[model samples]
Target chain A: FFQISPAPSYANPGIMQETISVNDVKDAHKNWCNALLAISKAHSEGGLAKSKPLASEIIDAAYAYQFGPVAFKPTWAYGKKTFRTTKDGALSYFIGDNPKFNDPGFGIGSPGNKDYPNLKNRSPWVKCTPENFAIQIFGNTAIGMGWVHFEAADGYKSKVDKTLSYIRDDEGNLRITVHHSSTPYSW
Target chain B: FFQISPAPSYANPGIMQETISVNDVKDAHKNWCNALLAISKAHSEGGLAKSKPLASEIIDAAYAYQFGPVAFKPTWAYGKKTFRTTKDGALSYFIGDNPKFNDPGFGIGSPGNKDYPNLKNRSPWVKCTPENFAIQIFGNTAIGMGWVHFEAADGYKSKVDKTLSYIRDDEGNLRITVHHSSTPYSW
Candidate 1:
């Protein structure tokens, strides 16, 4: 009756892969943004330490995972309020004891203030929606982008152009390999 | 005697895949940046026409590719000086016949002055080097980041944080999937 369980559909692998990849990106993106909001909430309640492990879970080990080899260089290191140059430094700034925001250097510094690394402050990000979300899926790898709208706790509203690239680990989880965010430009 | 050529060495596919992906991204990035300089040169010598084809080749077809389906939304809209919101609008600003430099709006208008959209004016980019280049290779897809320094033909110099995400097509060609560039924030 069962003839070798139907060969697993390796035929049309490209099309199948694209479908899976797109869906994966969509799901991962939702989780990723939600995680940001969750971290903010946790920070507001208990402080940045509460969000450290959550942050680690979302980011790729290559970028910085305490349990993994530390190859420090975050994709989110841009703008005046940027993350630390090294993953450890960034983690420290976020959850550890360090208060040197706005370091004056090109590719080096903690552009974020010395307060809580909670992005939305005590205010929660009600909506982290993408204006023109675009995704490019390549097998188990993908990149996604769009102008992210962050509706903060208050009536405060802001948006940043966000881009992220990631790969699925062995366990089929999307780990953010690159993250870059910045406000739109104007003179 | 051949013995199936030792099974074609599929034993360490992960390691092999990483090496190939990293190399591919490096080559693509080099070509991509150099293309910017080349386009600038062409714009200076001829005009936007000279650079149009080059631009089309590097960018994802979704933005503007005559031979492919016209899917608006480019992977390379970054910073304050951006193109129009729509693809046709952006194409109009880029190689189109119109020239509306700065229209007042939050997410509308090209902050770039009416010129040959080659970025650095008539000045050739002598150097577009990265301060700290970081790359995360994910099979056929990848993302790269660094603070790029631009030295223009007029001796004007500036730096912008740049990030890009891309995937290799079936033909093994790299197409930029996302590009975001911004100046460092300051208070």
Candidate 2:
């Protein structure tokens, strides 16, 4: 019997043919972001936001697992401390805010755990990029773990092990939530 | 600049304190039965071959390349075939002759030209279990592309993109070898 979790590699854009084109990478990333955006949208609005809710649902699940379920609130910083609401009311942060989201042990060079206090204590999640290599996909889970290229407070470029987890609820959909990463100051 | 490839979740094994065991899966019947063993060792070769003939010498100097500079030569297979003196004998099927050897392909997958006719064939060399994943060190002559896992056949299991190239003088002394994969497969 096939396992329960769905395979992310074969999402809407899976490798049907044996040949892997460069576009496959970009498409997969787009699919991944789309998956996340769905969830992010749901957390912001009660209206049905399409299949994207899966991503939001997973995020809520992570919050349920980490902070209390109440913490599932959605917040996106577009820039440093400078934040504003969009037409749809999604909070976007443009200013660079501490990635810890307010975790007490903000930068402890560890894959943050619930024990870290609040999301603020968590490692900052970076917007996904191509440099982050896709490592493995197990069963229905596609695990993309890589060294997030970021600058250390000391002005040095540091790579941290950033992990993103994607999963689906009872309904068939793709979602990404639950991130664990470490930075230099994380210790 | 990220000089090092990010290690997998299983890299520090210490990162995740767990005692996980896996029951082996059945194998796919491949040519010469040598690729099977190559894949096996790859499973535990700590990523890349501990040592190998410098990819430069192997590609530019290996007399084997004198014909075409093959992409996916099994490391040991290259060593043995190059000697031909019956001194350092058969370590792989490609080195030893099976009816498949005469199949008009340069090696087992000689028609490999079909997949990678231009030295860009994703799979440059092949190996069996014990070596498990096929390693292809592609640098086009730089630090070298190391440890890439491509979805391989035999039931779509991800194969380690590991393969080595070697070069020997009148007397074999591993002229210039390099190791590319800094981490192991996550799955």
Candidate 3:
């Protein structure tokens, strides 16, 4: 037997009609970690030729670029290139080799040079672990802040303070609208 | 004549049932700027005892502390005190004078010493202007990135790179879920 009810009318328009939960935010973080590892693996196995498409796909699926400009601030980005709002800028930051932007390919890694001494011995990343210190959920949106640890194949380890805001997309998938990463500040 | 319609059901559950607009994000930024100026004015006229309650009210109205921890990284905050996730921490950053945290009362300004040379001659802020570079809208959530310039009563000026994420709350008010601010990175 089916009981039919009146069309649902929200009494409080300010309240989220479809709520996002804390578990949902955690799942989004897990998905992002897996995607990063995948990009690194693709880079190591096939180079930019192989990793570019995968990275593009991941960016399209994870970021809200189609919706509008994404607020992305990479850890090492400085000067005018600090904020990467366009999709192409995001691509350069993830895959590298773009002459326009002075990116060391943060996700893929670049050859060691005088300018990038730290990247010289680095290989593709082998691991990524997200330790979320705080998570806030509001309706279809959520924000997470914490530290993300990375281990390179060459055993080089690094960590960054990361803040991300996720929103549910048209297809019910969570997508990142804001991403800010930086090394922990010290005296 | 009365017409009866069936209950409204979302065909795409993943899509936002209620969408936020670009204008909404801009309005939120304006509200934030006004609140900052109000806090400064309150401090200039009365001091922390008078400004603290006003700051508290503004924080409660503008931020999503009621939802959960906010991902707030204030400019000039260093070491372990960088992120202010709790309402109390947020209050301290805005009104200052907390012994627990090493805040110089960023919003209210403190008497400067050898440790804070730059703050020595600084006075309460008299003006705040937001220049948004990018804005992204997703359903009931939006993210904005831009520069916020401040001018002190004594003619001192400063600016910071700011990124804020807003979500419509239970009362239909736009509230900040993520707030990250820092001095622009240079070579």
Clashes of each: 3, 73, 4
Regions more than 4 Å wrong, model 3: A1-20, A44-46, A110-123, A153-157, A169-172, B1-20, B109-119, B153-156, B169-172
lDDT at residue A76 of model 1 (Cα atoms): 41
Best by lDDT: 3
- Chain B TM-score by candidate, in order shown: 0.61, 0.21, 0.85
Which sequence of candidate numbers ranks them by DockQ, best first?
A: 3, 1, 2
Comparison by TM-score, 1 against 2, better one: 1
Q: On residues A1-187, what C-alpha lDDT tens digit does candidate 2 reach at each position?
A: 1224444554443332222233433344455444343433343343234323443343333322321111011122111211111211111111112343332221222223445333322333233333444333333333343344433222333343333333333443323332333221110
Ten residues in sequence with the least summed lDDT for candidate 1 chain B? B102-111
Task: Identify the runs in model 2 with alpha carbons over 4 angstroms from their true place.
Answer: A1-18, A46-53, A56-117, A120-127, A132-187, B1-22, B25-187
DockQ of each: 0.23, 0.02, 0.29
Candidate 1 lDDT, B1-187, residue by residue in tens: 0112333547733322323266666766676557667656665566656655654443444232332222122223344434233444444434444444322211111223424244322345555665445676655555666666667666767667766555555555666556566666444
Candidate order by decreasing TM-score: 3, 1, 2
lDDT of 3 by residue, A1-187 (tens): 1223456569623332466678878888888888888988998899889999999999999998887778888776766787888889998888877888867777784233425523555488778898887887766777888878888787778777788888787567888888888766442
Put down candidate 1 lDDT per residue, A1-187, tens digits, no spaces: 0112333556633322222366676776677657667656665566545666755544433332432332222334445435344554555433444454422211112223424243222355556676545666666666666666667666566667766656666555666666666666544
Q: What interface RMSD does every candidate have?
A: 6.4, 20.3, 2.7
lDDT of 2 by residue, B1-187 (tens): 0123345565543332211111110111122134433433342242224212121222233223342222232322221122121111222222222332211112222223333223223232344332322211112111111223333333322332222332223332222222111122111
List model 3 lDDT by residue over B59-152, tens digit each. Answer: 9999989877888887766667778888888988887777777576677643334255234554777788887878887667778888788887
